[model samples]
Target: MNAELLARFHGVIPAGGVGTRLWPLSRAAAPKFLHDLTGSGSTLIRATYERLIPLAGGNIMVVTGRAHRTAVIAQLPEVSDLDLVLEPEPKDSAAAIGLAAAILYRRNPETIMGSFAADQVIRPVEVFQEAVLEAIHTAATGKIVTIGIRPTLPSTAFGYIRAGERLDISGAPTARDVVEFVEKPDGDTARRYLADGGYLWNAGMFVAPVSLMLKHLERSEPELYAGLTEIAAAWETPARDETMDRIWPNLPKTAIDYAVAEPAAAAGDVAVIPGVFDWDDVGDFAAIGRLNPASEETGVTVIGDVKRVYSDNATGVVVTDSKRVIALIGIHDVVVVDTPDALLVTTKEHAQSVKNTVDTLKKNGVMDVL
Candidate 1:
C-alpha cells in the first residue's frame, strides 16, 4: 500500500449498541465493547483502535452515545475531543456514519473513510489490514466499497453479500462487483448460499470517499442527509451542541446497509473485497466461550479471577466480577455470569435468547440490573 494513499484514509469506529444478549456482564451502563471479553487484557474498543492504528495512524474517530462519553474517553485517551462524536440518542448507523462522513467531507472531500464496528473481534491484524488496503484502493476508484468476510459457515445471524465478478482495479486483486445485499436467510437458504460459493457474510464494514458517501446518502435519503449536513456544519463551531440537540432527534434511524449500501449496489456503485481473516462479533456468552481459551482441566472458560470459579464435570463459560466463589457441577455448555447486582445462568445453546431475558426484565420494570 502506498504511504500517500494510506495517509488519506481515516478510520471511523461506531461504538454503540447495549449488547443485551451479553447481559449481567454487558449492561447499558457498561456495554460489552467496554469489557475485556477476550481475556486479552484490552477492551473490545481499545483493541479495535489498536488494530487500526497501523493503517489509519492517528486519523481515527469514535462515534458513541452521550452516556458513554466519559468512559470512552477514559478507555481511549489518545482520541481527541474533536474526533470523539457523541450522539444524544441512538439514531442507528445511517445517522451515526452519515454524520461522520458529512463532517469529514467538510474537512476534506478526498478523505477515504472506513467504518469498523467497535465491538467485533478480528484476529491476525495483518490480514485484516491487507483487506482494508484493497478496500481503500477499490474505493479510490469512485465506488463505495465494503470488506465482506469470506463465509466460514451458513450463519443465519449475519446478512449475505453476493459477489458478481472480479474487478481489474489496480492494487486490488480480489475486488469483486457486489451483485446484491441479502437479508438474513432461513436455515435452508443459508445452506444453499454456503454451497453457492459466491456469497460472503456482510460484516457491515464500509470504505468510501467522504464525498461519494454523502452523495449516495443525499440521493437515497435526502432528509437524513440534510439534517446531518446541518449538524456537521456546526460540529467544529460553538453551536455544535445546540445544533446536535435540535436536529439529531429528527434524523431518520436506519442502518448504513439499508440507507446506503443496498441502494448503491442496486445502482451498480458498490464493490466488495473478500476479507479472509478470523472475525467474531462476540454476540453472546457462547461467543465469549469461543473467543477465550477454555481451562484444560475442567473444560470451561473463565473471565476475571479463575481461582474464584470451580467446576466439576462442567464445560462452559464463567464470568465473575464479585468476590463470591462460583461453583458448577455436572453442567455442560453452561454460562454463568456473576455481577454485583445480577446473575445469569444459561446454556450455550440458548445464549442467543438471552436478549429476551433482558426484554422481560425491562417489561417488569427491573431497572436496577439493566
Candidate 2:
C-alpha cells in the first residue's frame, strides 16, 4: 500500500453491467469486463483491483450480480468470497454502491473511500497515481471530489460536468466546485459546451469520506438509505448478512451520481478536477481502435483466416466466418464486429448506435447471441 494515501480509504468497483451495448462480444454470460482488449494481461475486474492497489489495502470490494460471480471469482483468485458483495439480481450502480458503502460503514464508519467504474482505462501510472493523490487531498474536506477528464471533443455520448471557479482549500493545489452536472447532450449542445470551456467528461470516479456520501444519500434517497443504514448497523451482528439479503433486493437501482453527487452538487459540496492522466472508460469495441497510439495505425480483427482481409481499415474489425465474409475493400473508420450468431458493420460515426441495435434485437427476440 502507498503509505501516503494510507489504509483509511478503500475501493468499490461496480462490475455488474450486462454490457448490452457491446452485444456480439459482450453477452450475458460473458461480459465485456472479462474481455482481454484492455491489455492488462488480466480481465478488466482484475485490472481494476490492481489499479487501486496503491491506495487500498485488505478492504477492496467488488459488487456484482450473482450471474457473474463465478467469472469474477475465476478472474480474481486472490479475492476472497466475502470481499465480493453479490447481488441476487442486477441492481443498477446506485444500489451496488450503497451495498458496498453499507459493508464498509459497518466495518469502519470514519473511513474515506474511492469508487471506480471497472471499464475505464488509465495510462501512465505516475499521472494516474497522482490524480488519486490529488483526489485524496481534496477528500480531506467533507465534500465529494470527482476526477474529471479534460475534454478532447464535444462528445454527445458522455455526460458533462460544469465546474465552477476554483474553490479555495487550505492545502489542496487546484480544485473547482461543480457549477452543474449535465447528462449526455446533443451534438450542437456538446459543441457549445466544449467551446465554452467549463465542462468536463464525467469520469464517474469519486473520492469522499464514506460517511459524507452515506449522510447525503440518506437525505436524498431516504427509504433506500434506511435499508443501507440498517445493514451497516448489523454488519458484525448475526443479522448483518440477513439484513443485506433482504434489503438489497428492494433497493432502488440507480447510479451514485444520480442518487448522491447530483444532489450533493445542488447543496454545493461537489468539486471537480481535470485528472492527471489520459483517461478512457473503454466503453465499447470502437475504443479498441481509439486506445492505440495515434501515430500507429493499429487494428483488431477476429475469426477471419485471410491475411488479405480487413486491409485499408484505419481502426479494427472483428470478422466471424459464419456471416457474409467482411471483405473491407477500402473502408476507413469502421469496426466490423461479428459473432457466429450476430454481425455488426458500423462506421465510427455510428459506433454509439450499436447499443440501440442490441435493444432492437432484444425486442425482436433475437437474443440468441445478444
Candidate 3:
C-alpha cells in the first residue's frame, strides 16, 4: 500500500440515509448500515471502516444523524468523539459531506478527504485499494476524483459517468477526465451505454482536496456553503450545538451529485478512476439475493440462521432474526422478511416497491409495524 499517499488523505463516511427498500431488516430507528445484511459478522459501517483503515489509518470521520450517533459510535468503537460529526438532522449528502469537509479544512487546509457511503458493499479488497490509491493521486492534482465502477451489465440502477480523456498522473495510470455525469437511464439507454463502452457506473465514492470540494460548493451552492462554514467555525467550540441549530435546518437538502459533481464536471474539474471490485449497494432483496452465495443453488437466500429456515420446492429469499421457524413450500420468486414486530411477504419482482408499503403503513397510521 502507498503509506505516504494514504497518510496524506482522510476518510469520511456519510451515514445518514435510511435504506427504505430493505425495510423490516432496515428501519428508521436502526438503518441498514448498522446491520450486517450480508451476515458478514460486522455491520456495513464497520466493514466500510475496515476497508479504508489500512490506507486512512486513524484519520477517519463519520457524519451521521443525532438519533443514530450513539449507535454509530457503539458500532465503531475505535472512532474517537472528535472524529465523529453528528448532524442534528438529515440534510442529504451535500450537507453531510460538506460539513465533514469544512471541519477537515479547519483542521488543516491541505487535508485530502474521500467520502464513501456507509451502506455500500465492495469486494476483493486489493483491487478496491488500488482504485482508491489511484483516486487519491488524481484528487491530489486539484480535481474532484470519483471512483467509477466498470459496468459489468446493463443495469439501470446506477448513474453513469462518461469518461473523456486520460490524465497524466503518476501511480494513477488509469485515471481519466470525467466528461459528464448521467442520471440512471432506461433499459435501452443502459444497454447502449454498456455496448458503447465509454460510461462507468458512478459509485458515489469521491476523493478530493478539502479546498477543491469547498470551492466547488461555494460556486455551485453558495447558501449551503455558507451554512457549512458557519457550523464548521463553531464545531469544536461551546457554540456548536447552538450554531448548528440555527443554521443546519435551513441548509439546502441537496445531494452532492446535483450540488457539486455535475457542475464541477461541466466546468472541467472532475476525474474518474475505474474500479474493478465486486460492488453492491444492497438496495433491495433482489440485490441481497444476488449477493448471497447460498442463493446460487436454488435461487433461495437466507440472511439469518439457516437451521431455522426450511423450504420445500421453494425458490426465493427468506430473512429472519426471530426465533420462530420460517417454512416455505412451493413458493417461487418470493421474498419473506420476518421480524419480531412485523412480517413482510412479497415477490422478488416487487422488491423495489417495498418502500411504497412503508409509505402506505405510515399513511394508515400503522406505526407499530413501521
Candidate 4:
C-alpha cells in the first residue's frame, strides 16, 4: 500500500437513500444499506466503509440523513463527529456529495475527494484499488474523474459513459477523456451501446480535487453551491444546526449526474478511468438474486437463517429478518421477504415494481409498515 498516495486522498460516502425497491426487508426506518443483504455478516454501509479504509484511512466522511445518523454512527464507530456530514433532509446526491466537497474545501482546498455510494458491491478488491489510485492521480491534475465500469452486457439498468481520446498520464495509463454520459437506454439503444466499443456503465464513483468540484458546482449550480458554502462555513460553529435547518430543505433536489457530470463532460473537463472489476448497485430483488443466486440443490437463495427456510421445487429468493419459518413449495421465480411488520411477495419479473408497493401503502395511509 502506498501510504503517501493514500494520505493525499479523502473518501466521501453518501448514504441517504431509502431503497424503496427492496421493501419489507429494506424499510423507511432501516434502508438497504443498513441491512446485510449479501449474507456476509456485515451491513452494506459497513462493507463500504471497510472498502475505503485502506485508501483514505481516517480521512473519510459519510453524509447521511439525520434520521439514520445514529445507525450510521453505530455501524461506523471509527468515524468522528467532524467526519459525519449529516443532512437534515434528503436533497439527493448533489446536495449530499456537494456538501461533503464544500466542507472538505473549507478544511483543505487541495484535498482530493472521492465519492462512493453506500449501497454498492464490488469484487476483486485489488482491481478496485488500482482503479481508484489511477482516478486519484487523474483528479489531482484539475480534471473531474469518474470510474466507468466495463459493460458485460447491454444492461439497461445503468447509465453509460462514452470514452474519447486516451490521456497519456504516467500513473493513470488507462485514463481517457469522457465523451458524454447517456441515461439508461431502451433494449435496442442498450444493444447499440454494447455494439459500440467506446461505452462503459456509469458506476457513480467520482474523484476530484475539492477545489475543482466546488468550482464546477459554483458554475453549474450557483444557488446550491452558495447554500452549501454557507453551511460549510458554519459546519463547526454553533450556527451549524440553525444554518442547515433553515437552508437545506429549500435547496434543489438534483443528482450529481445532471447537476455536474453531464455539464462537465460537455465542456470536456470530465475524465473516465475504466474499471474492470465486477460491480453491482443492488438496486432491486433481481439484482440480489443475480449477486447471490439460488442454491443448485435447494433452488432457493436464502439471505438469513438458512435452517429456518425449507424449500422444495421452489426457485427464487427468500429473505427473513424475523424468527418465522419460511416454507416455499412448487413456487418458481417468486420473491418472499418477511419482516416483523410486513411481507413482500412478488415475482422476480415484477421486482422492479416493488417501489410501487411502497407508494400503495402510502396511499392507503399505512405508515406503520413503512
Clashes per candidate (backbone, < 3 Å): 0, 1, 0, 0
Q: For model 2, how does the per-residue alpha-carbon lDDT over 25-75 read when each residue is reduced to its tens digit? A: 778888878776554466667778888886676668887877888888888
Q: What digit string (tens of lDDT, one per residue) describes model 1 on residues 158-178?
A: 999999999999999999999
lDDT-superior candidate, 1 or 3: 1
Consecutive 10-residue window with the lowest summed lDDT within model 1:
304-313
RMSD of 2: 3.2
* Cα-based lDDT for every prediction: 0.94, 0.75, 0.90, 0.90
RMSD of 3: 1.6
Whole-model alpha-carbon lDDT for candidate 2: 0.75
Q: Is candidate 2 or candidate 4 better by TM-score?
A: 4
State candidate 1's TM-score. 0.99
Off by over 4 Å in 4: 1-5
Better of 1 and 4 by lDDT: 1
Winner by lDDT: 1
On a 0 to 100 scale, what is the lDDT of residue 326 in model 2?
54
| Candidate number that wins on TM-score, 2 or 3 | 3
Pick the TM-score winner. Answer: 1
Error of 4 at 160 (Å): 1.2
RMSD of each: 0.9, 3.2, 1.6, 1.4
